[model samples]
Target chain A: MFVLASASKARQKLLDQIALRHKVIVSDFDETQLQEPDPILKVKLLAKGKADSALKKLIEENHALNTYQALLGCDSLFEFKGEIFEKPINKEQLISRWKRMSGQSGFLHTGHYLISLDNSKSDMESISQNNSCEGVVSTKIEFMNLSNFEINKYASTSEPYNCAGGFAIEGNGGLFIKKIDGCFSNVIGLSLPWLKNNLEKYGLSRLLLDR
Target chain B: MFVLASASKARQKLLDQIALRHKVIVSDFDETQLQEPDPILKVKLLAKGKADSALKKLIEENHALNTYQALLGCDSLFEFKGEIFEKPINKEQLISRWKRMSGQSGFLHTGHYLISLDNSKSDMESISQNNSCEGVVSTKIEFMNLSNFEINKYASTSEPYNCAGGFAIEGNGGLFIKKIDGCFSNVIGLSLPWLKNNLEKYGLSRLLLDR
Candidate 1:
């Protein structure tokens, strides 16, 4: 079993797609307070922060953190024309983002951190020395050459407000996507192939197989 | 307003994505009976046949076919290593197809036919001689290197049984897709960019704008 250290529905849906048994635990990490100059390191640090925060909470709440073999955390960001974009907070920002991103290609970077728990350790001090693995998946996504009317129309809807880069590749905004150049799952929130490759190292690939 | 000449849920969902008001009427044209050596011509002919059949059905049912500006028909096929693949008939075929398609790239060809309906036409005969426009959008899709266990596990699901090439780019099978190189919507059964560009020529792009 695995514990997911995030609250994204897309990540949960992805886990369900692969039939992975997992538990969701929302982290209390404040992402807005985190910042870094490098885009790649930024996401990696955030994912680590989320995992650490979630694990700390589980330990405090007396949850069975040691029962699960692995704890997963993830963070994603959109890079368009040298600028990094997080989720648009309002309709105006979404409209502006779409206008700049229309007919353009951008990179979506998702970072994953897996904390492996040692069940043999009974004390919190020993658990502090747990092994954590990390990986990053980047995908290039191209948006359709949208008209002004189309941009405004999509911005008026609530779809863009809740997604990174003002669009959801798996939702209604899917039609506006022109193409992608890497792991499709990474664009959705996580990379199954990347996860499988990492999980193989821990001898947990069986967890992904058919029940 | 537009009339859709097929019953594919993906196409309907795409129409809804773009906020296009339309009605669906399944074409009676038998896809199995239509075949052409050239993949492009094959899809175009089938799309034309579907549009023609759907227009005739509307006239028979007295559904005011002339009121609509355009009647859209679409058909898609997957070409892997020069062979055409439609929807798999059984699980065995799906497993076999996935074995050959794993870690490979394929072309998804979607043909769209828009029959321009002139409202001035009072009878079926004039409507029968209406002008029609056609376009074909082909997308290159790359599949992840999947293990036999993964392939078999996904093949057992109902997602592979109902889609062309034994996989759906928009469903659970999406995780298995590595990348796409053209119109993403084309792989989903309709090419929105192609459709919007074509619709613009008929002065009907407004139909796609805000209601």
Candidate 2:
């Protein structure tokens, strides 16, 4: 059995795509407290924090955390040039970001962390990053040169307020994406190919096979 | 106003992405009757036929066809090597196609035909393909090396029976697509960027901007 430690609908839909059986337990980790400036490291830390917090909650609930083969957590952020973007806090910020992102290629980095609690790990290394397997999937997204009218139309929608980069690739914003040079699923928030490859290392590929 | 001459949910969703208000009137054109072996020509004929049929129906119903700016029709086919794949006929065919497509790159060709009924064109040339601007948008899609288990699981579902190439990039099959090298929306059944560019030529981009 596998566990997903985030409550994102995109991630859940991804799991459904692969027919993976999993349960969602929202982690209460405060992502706003993360202060890392490097976008990649920041995403990795947030994913790890969410996974660790979820595992702790399971343990506290006497849920036999070791019974589950793996717990998966993921975090994603958008980076254009050198700046990182999460969800915009207001309509003004959202519009400002869209103006800058129009007609440009950006990188979407999604950090995935898998914590295996199979009762076979060394006691000292169980909770450390070294003990867990992690991977970061990146996809290049090229946006169309959108006019101000188009940009304002997209920014006026609520989809930009809850998604990284002030846009949702799976929603109305998909119209503005001209090209994608990497895993399409990564742009949607999770990288299925990366997740599949990582699961093989943990001998959990059978979960997908049997399903 | 624009008229969409197909009932495909994917195409409708794409139209909705840009907030374009349109009416869907399913065309009665028979695609299988096409004898053209060239995939590109076959798709173009199919799109044109659909648009022509829908326009005819609208005229029959006295829908004020001249008042509409454009009528749009689209048809897509997956070309792998030299063969054109529309929908897989059955589970066995779907599984066979997936086996051959595993880890391979193919092209998705979407033929878009816009029949402009704006008040500016001569009555005789308005409905002809020569007067109606058309385009073909092609996107290269790379599929993951799917396992037999994965292929069988996906083939068991009805998703493979209704879409070109027996898989949908916006659905479960997205898990197996590793990369895309052109417009992503083209793979989804329509190319928004291409549509936008073409609409500009017809002075119909105003439809989107004014919305």
Candidate 3:
């Protein structure tokens, strides 16, 4: 079995889409601790922190080697016009962000960190020394011009409140996306291509549990 | 209600994803009659044909005006190395196609056709003259290198059999897609932005049956 170190439902559904045998174990780490200035590095650092924190929990529970083969952590942030945009805190923020983002292009960066529990040693020091993989993928998303009414109506829906960049590409927000210029899944959450590549490299492709 | 004039489940789910209230009415159009050579035009003509056929069916049943607001038809084709690919005929063909497609990039073109039932005239002649919209969207898709075993394993599944380009970006085949360089939804079946644009233009954006 594999473990996902995040509580995002989109990420969980993405794993299920690929038929991967995985379970969600929300990381205990505080995401706000990372105030990294660089948009790309901010997500990367947060993902790494989440994975490490999850690993610490698994080790403490003495279930690292036997129950799960690996742990995956991912975080995404959007950069528009040299500004970092995380999830909007409220409807006003979301509406204001949409006003600025309408008819514009932005980059969404998703950082991925994976820890393999293949080492014979179960100690914390040994796992850190032995197995891990990291990568970041970005997708350029363009939105169509939106009128005030369209933006307000979209904000009224429950789709945008908790999602990164105030939009969910796989939900109602899909109607506003003009086009994407990179890994589509990366924009949604985790990059399936990136995940498959790493899983194959670690001889964990067998975990697909394809239905 | 909006009518979908094709048999593609992906397109239906796409409309649903955007909270659109639509119904499916698979066209009885003979797709093979069109021998169009241009990948872009091939899909466009087929989409138009399907919509026309479905309109004819609705007209015959005298249900076009009262039961639905519009009908949508879509068709997709993949262009790789100057050749057009529809669904593969068999497993051997699918495997061979993947071997050529692996580690390469290709274009997926999806054509969209919509017929608005806003006009009061119910006869076939009046409908053809008054309300229709057409467009085509394309996405450049790149594939990751796959070993023979991986290719064969994927081919053994039912995912590629009925899908255009011998792959489904929303399914297990997502593992093989490196990235897409255009509208991601078009690669699946319909272009959500395209549909939304046309719908909004015709004052039909209210079709969104948001839950």
Candidate 4:
């Protein structure tokens, strides 16, 4: 089994898609603790911090970490017009963002940090990036042009407010996207190919087949 | 409301994604009747035939298709190594195909046929391609190299046998795909953006907003 260090249902579904059994352990890391301007770097930092925070919690609880082979943390941010976007702040912001995003293209960057706990370390705090697998997967998305009426109508639905960049590709927003030009799974939340490669490259193929 | 003239659950889910109310009517067209060798043309013909057959059934049953504004038919085929692939014939075929397709790139084409019924004619038979909206959407898919064990294990599951290319992108196959470079929804079954454009451009914008 593996540990997922996030509260996102979308990320959890991604693991289910690949038949990976995982335990959801929400990280206590405050997302607002970082004010990084770079989208890629910000997501990577958040992903690592989330995993680290979860690890700290596991150790504190005296949890038997041996049951789990790996822990994965993920964070997604939409980069549009050189701005970082997570979930829209409010209805007005979501509507306004949709208006501006119409007929435009953006990049969705999802950072994945996977911690393999096979290596025994008496000093848990000694764990560092020296032996971690991580990456920032990005996908380009284009939105179809929308009129004011269309925008208002879609914004009236509750779907747009909860997703990054004010849209959910797998939900109602699927109709609005004109195209995507990269790893499609990254736009949803996790990059499956990236995860599969890391699982194999990090000597964790057991996770791939043991399911 | 619209009439979905196909039996694909994936296509039905695409309509649900956009909150479009649809009445699903299975077409009676015999798929084996099509001997078309060209992948693009074959899908287009199949899509149109499915829609036509459904329309004929509706008229025969004296069904009130007037309640529906449009009818959509969809067909998907995978083009790999200049060969058309629908579903793998059997486990051996699937394994062999996977072995040959490992680490290879191919195209997934989904043909969309939309028939607008608002501007109807006295004779339904008079309707021609000139008045209909259709297109074949294609997406490039790259597969990751798989060992023999991986192929055999994936084939053991019922997932790969039913998909067009011996893989389900939205299922366990999601891990096997390295990247895709086109309309993501098309790979699933329907092209949402293409449908959105046809709805708006062909003066069927009501389908988009009234949904």
Candidate 5:
């Protein structure tokens, strides 16, 4: 069994499509604590934090799941014009974000980490005898010129507030995107390709068989 | 009524999502006739050719629908390492293309033409008007590394053979994408935001709403 250290529906949906059996465990770390100019590093740190938190939680609860094989943690952020646009706080903030993003381009960065857990410390050391892998994937997005009315109408759906950059690429907000220059799933809040690649490192390619 | 000048399930699914009412008319133009180094130009030319072909067919058939306002034509191509990768010609070619793209970054260019059929009086005028509003939107895609076994497995599904660039960003191909850098729909063979923008320019926002 694998543990997913996130509450994002997009990430869960991606894992589900791949037919991976995973249990959801939301991380307890506060993302605002991490500060970095480079969006990639910030997201990577958050993913790492989530993984560590999940590991600690399982230990504290003395859960039998400690024998589980792996834990996956993920985090994403929207970077536009050299600034990071985190999740919005309110409708006005979402509207303002849309106004600023009108006819502009941006990057969506998703960081992923895979942590291997073993019941015995010796087993963990044996697996690490080779190499552990972790990485970040980024998707670029171009916004079409949007009018105030269109922006307001989309914002009213309240889908943008919970998503980074105040837009959910897979939902109603899809209409505002002029073009995408990278992985569509990354903007949806996870990178399925990246996950598949990492899973291969563990000799776990069987998970991808057509259902 | 709107006329769509192409037969692509991906594009059809997009229009359906937006609830746009339209009739599909497959183009009879020979795509191999065009020679262009720039992928953007290639797709735009193909799209325009398709629009022109559809228009001619409509006139020759003397279709009863009189007040059709807008006509849409679309084309897409896969670009990798400066080379344009059109749809795979055979199973072997499709497998090779999938192998090459298993863990690489690429771009998908989708061109759209929204022609105002009601405004076109003569064939010359129709061609001129079609050229004015046509544009290409490019979406970037990055794939994660896959082993030969995984590549062969995905290829066996035969999903990549019919798709431009040998992968469907919205279907099983989602497993291979690490991130997308532009419009998700563009990679799927349409650009909803671009379509919406063009529609709004003609005071046809109601088309989207009325759906």
Candidate 6:
């Protein structure tokens, strides 16, 4: 059994693409509490936090799921010239964010964590032995030279507010992207290839082979 | 005016995503004669061929509407390792292709061309001065580990043969992809972000300014 620690539709859709049977659990952890300069590291840390939170919640719920089952967590950040762009809370902020990103290149970092819960309650066991690995995949995006009118109109779509960096490359914000230098799926909120590669390291092939 | 030089449904759907007003023209170009080993250059050359062929046909048929319009053409290629994968012609080849790429990483390259047509014959004298550009965008995709049963089930859906890589990442093939390393649009047979940027050089935006 696989557990996904996220509420993002994009992430869910990415998993669906792989035909992976997984359950979604929204992480209740507060992301704003983390203080980090590097957006990539921040996302990775957040993903780990979400995984830990989810693992605890699942154990407390008395679910029959094996604690040793694979748990997946993900987080994303938009970085432009070393500045992290968080999710916009309002239309005006989204418009301003788009205006700032117009004609500029930015990086979207999506960090993923695969944690295998240890059913055995042993204090001496190493965490690495319990099987946890993390990685961050970054995608570079170039924004089209957008006019204020275009930016305002796109913001009106309300697609930007909930997305990091005030844009959803898979949604209406796609019109503002000029080019992408790295993984496009990362900007869409997940890097599917990276996820598969990481999952393979966690014995995904063996799991499927046994099944 | 934007004129699309192909009748592909996938291309049309992609254009619709940005709400770009475009007229489709079927280019009766001889694609068989232009086969080459270099996949990137081949796609670009094919796109250019389509654009030129459509431009000529439009000029001969609708002389009144043949002024200062930008012609857009696109082509896609699926490459695994160093080998280029074309659309499968038979069920056996399709099955073989899927078996090879079922759980592997592959590259999808989409080449785009924008050719600005001259209205007057006198202006055609300076055809070199007309704004024209070409670019190739690549996206990397990784497929999940698939069973023989899964491969046969998906191949039965008849979605593999029509796509360049024998898979449609946005459709039933999505269930096979584990992750994507490059642009999702490129894998979907077009790169809207790249198109938007290339169009910007012609003072055009994919998003309507007044929308």
The best candidate by DockQ is 3
Rank candidates, DockQ, best first. 3, 4, 2, 1, 5, 6
Give residue B72's lDDT in candidate 6 (0 to 100). 83
> Which ranges of candidate 5 are over 4 A from the true structure?
A16-68, A80-84, A117-140, A179-183, B16-42, B52-68, B79-84, B99-107, B117-132, B138-145, B177-184, B209-211
TM-score order of candidates, top first: 3, 4, 2, 1, 5, 6
TM-score of each: 0.88, 0.89, 0.96, 0.95, 0.77, 0.72
**How many angstroms is residue B76 displaced in model 1 relative to the true structure, after the best TM-score fit?**
1.5
Task: List, residue by residue over B67-164, the lDDT tens digit for candidate 6.
Answer: 44577878888988889888888888888887888768888988887776534444542342366788899877877777787677777766777889
- The parts of candidate 3 lying over 4 Å away from their true place are A62-64
For candidate 4, give the lDDT of residue A109.
96
What share of the reference contacts survives in each candidate? 0.50, 0.69, 0.77, 0.81, 0.67, 0.36
B1-211 per-residue lDDT for model 3 (tens digits) = 8889988888888988988888787788998888888998899899998998888878787653666787898999999988999999999999999999999999999999988886445566567447889999999999999988889888888889989999998888888898889888889998988988898878888886456
**Model 6, residue A110: displacement in angstroms?**
2.0
Tens digits of per-residue lDDT, candidate 4, B6-80, equal 888878888888878889999999999999999999999999999888878777785565676778888999999
Supply candidate 5's per-residue lDDT for A65.
Answer: 54
Stretches off by above 4 angstroms in model 2 are A62-69, A117-131, A206-211, B118-125, B128-131, B206-211
Model 4 chain A worst lDDT run, 10 consecutive residues: A122-131
Can you write out model 2's per-residue Cα lDDT over A38-91, one digit (the tens) per residue? Answer: 989988889889988887776677445566777888899999999999889898
Candidate 6, position B55, lDDT: 74
What pairs collide in candidate 4? none
Cα lDDT tens digits for candidate 3, A1-211:
8989999999988888878878788889998877778998889888888888887877777643576777899999899998999999999999999999999999999999988875445566567447888999999999989989889999998889878899998888988899899888899899999998898878888777366
lDDT of 6: 0.74
Better of 2 and 4 by lDDT: 4
**Which residues of candidate 1, in runs, are more than 4 Å off?**
A66-69, A116-131, A209-211, B66-69, B118-131, B209-211
Order of candidates by lDDT, top first?
Answer: 3, 4, 2, 1, 5, 6
Better of 3 and 6 by TM-score: 3
Q: What is the lDDT of residue A202 in candidate 3?
A: 84
